[model samples]
Target: MKILTTPDIPIATLFQNMREVYATCNVDVSWASEEVLNLPALNIVDVGTCILGSTTAEQNQLFTHRNSAGSNDIVIYFVEATDPPFNGCASHPLGMPGAVVVRTATQWTFAHEQGHVLGLNHVNDNDRLMTGNGTANITNPPPDLVASECNTMQASPITVNV
Candidate 1:
């Protein structure tokens, strides 16, 4: 999966955290600036990022196809939640095909959001990256498990045209 991050600082850091997790799985992932989410390398998992307060209604309006785009492309918006939901959530009120908003600027929050993009539901096991209740110590898991478990979770990526 490939993630497209805007020029936001915290959002870029969140992408870095995802790279770390991908490394743990021994999975190769490549991301570009807000400009490139369609490179051939990124077959599945296209995510976009924007900062809190910086994103305007105009920007959100551009992605109107998300509601029923049919493509698996999901945009992840980094917003400051009035109160961070301890549990994981999708950015839009309608839920599916929208970005995942995180209240904090922490790396764990990004990882948690990425977990949603990867098709893993909230797992109660704290050791698992998908464990969605608050922050779990899942920054890095064993590399083999990352690749193996992640593949097991999503056999075919619904996103990405490849």
Candidate 2:
């Protein structure tokens, strides 16, 4: 469970929040750039400039990034506000085990996507972080998200491949 954050306009607090969550999972995360390669067994998180609507070019870039991994790799893209109103989505290379795209909204978006990165899916549990519609119940979450997810992950003790 390694996360590589790309340079984006998100607030430092947001990144801090993400770091705190990953730390609990023992997930290793680092800041990387688009030019980076050789990241075989890691999760790549990128921040893309606002590109409204779903177009071929946008889809292509996303597909390229999502498919860059060999067998066990993941990519997450963070895009700014969009028009039609989409909170977030998970996409795969062809259509399975893909990257997650989160629409920057409140504080919980990062963690929600990180949930996907950790191989966790959305949960109906209102207090869980994977709750949709921003009801993630994690406002200013504790220092460790895995510990937070313990109730959900059944104390699986995830190790973030940072």
Candidate 3:
């Protein structure tokens, strides 16, 4: 995973937390980061904008980072706080998957979005990592990574980095 942050903020703790969380899945993540992006959160969206409500201009600004798949990397863009939203964007491009997380996001939000990046879909059960839309708290979810999802994640190109 490559974490992209604004020049003024730090994301090392969040990165470490994500590493710890992914450890339970036996996915060893190697990371690199760029903390010199001059852009701020408000520059991309309105002060209280929802992460998912990324406008074309905002997405274009984000795409400027060129998060392509030459390395099959999953990118994470850390921004400042937002309004009452899901915390960040968990978007999976057709060939390259990535996420956008707020500074307030917990480790679960990172892992949950990573699940989507790895081709996992949302489930109705709140006990699972892929649970949300209707009921997903910031707390612990149950132990569940179905065999199929595991296979899919294992098959991804980012597995090479593991």
Candidate 4:
């Protein structure tokens, strides 16, 4: 995995939160490296509502840093902000698997966007991690991931056996 963040944002806590979230389902989260990008133009990205299966020019530019080793590694980008009402986005250009998370996003936002990349969709329940109501709106302290969702995540091509 790879993480790209602006120089001002600290992602240590976010990474810890993400590891904890995925660990609930027995999925280990590890990264080879993290890069602190200094691109001011990309510091604040305009994702245009983060519609699934589509991406903006800024998103395309940011995702271009994805690892090209053909290992299906995931890249997480931390930006200053996205369009209003969205804290993170999982939409990427074709053949690119990555997500963009804002600096102010909830702890679960990283995991939630990753769930989308792993083929999990929004459920209406607030107690679940995949809730479309927003991670900040989750009523439960640690959101739940049902068995089916876990299965979906493990079955994604990006997942591999240890």
Who wins the lDDT comparison? 4
Question: Residue 57 lDDT in model 1?
Answer: 41
- Tell me the lDDT of model 4 at 130: 93
Models 1 onward score TM values of 0.52, 0.52, 0.68, 0.87
Q: Candidate 2's C-alpha lDDT?
A: 0.45
Candidate 3 residue 153 Cα shift, in angstroms, is 1.0
The best-first sequence of candidates by TM-score reads: 4, 3, 1, 2
Compared with the true structure, what per-residue lDDT tens digits does model 2 show for residues 82-127? 2244444443434323333334455656556556645566665555
In order, the Cα lDDT scores of the candidates are 0.44, 0.45, 0.56, 0.78
Worst 10 residues of 3 by lDDT: 44-53
Tell me the TM-score of model 4. 0.87
Count residue pairs with overlapping backbones in model 2.
7
Q: Model 1 over residues 63-137: C-alpha lDDT tens digits?
A: 443432345445554333322233224333223344544333355555555555555556666666665444545
* Model 4 pairs whose backbones collide: none
The count of residue-pair clashes in candidate 1 stands at: 1
Question: Which runs in model 3 stand beyond 4 Å of their true positions?
Answer: 1-10, 41-55, 66-70, 81-84, 92-96, 133-143
Residue 49 local lDDT, model 4: 71
Q: Residue-wise lDDT of candidate 3 within 1-162, one digit each (tens)?
A: 333444132455655655665566677776654533556554333323333324334544564564433547777666664334556665533444566666666546666666676666777666566776532353354335666667777776667642
Tens digits of per-residue lDDT for model 4 on 1-162?
Answer: 343444233467667777887888888877666766666787677788777798999888888776443447777788777765478889887778888887778878888998898889999999999999989999986789999998898899998879
State the local distance difference test value for candidate 4: 0.78
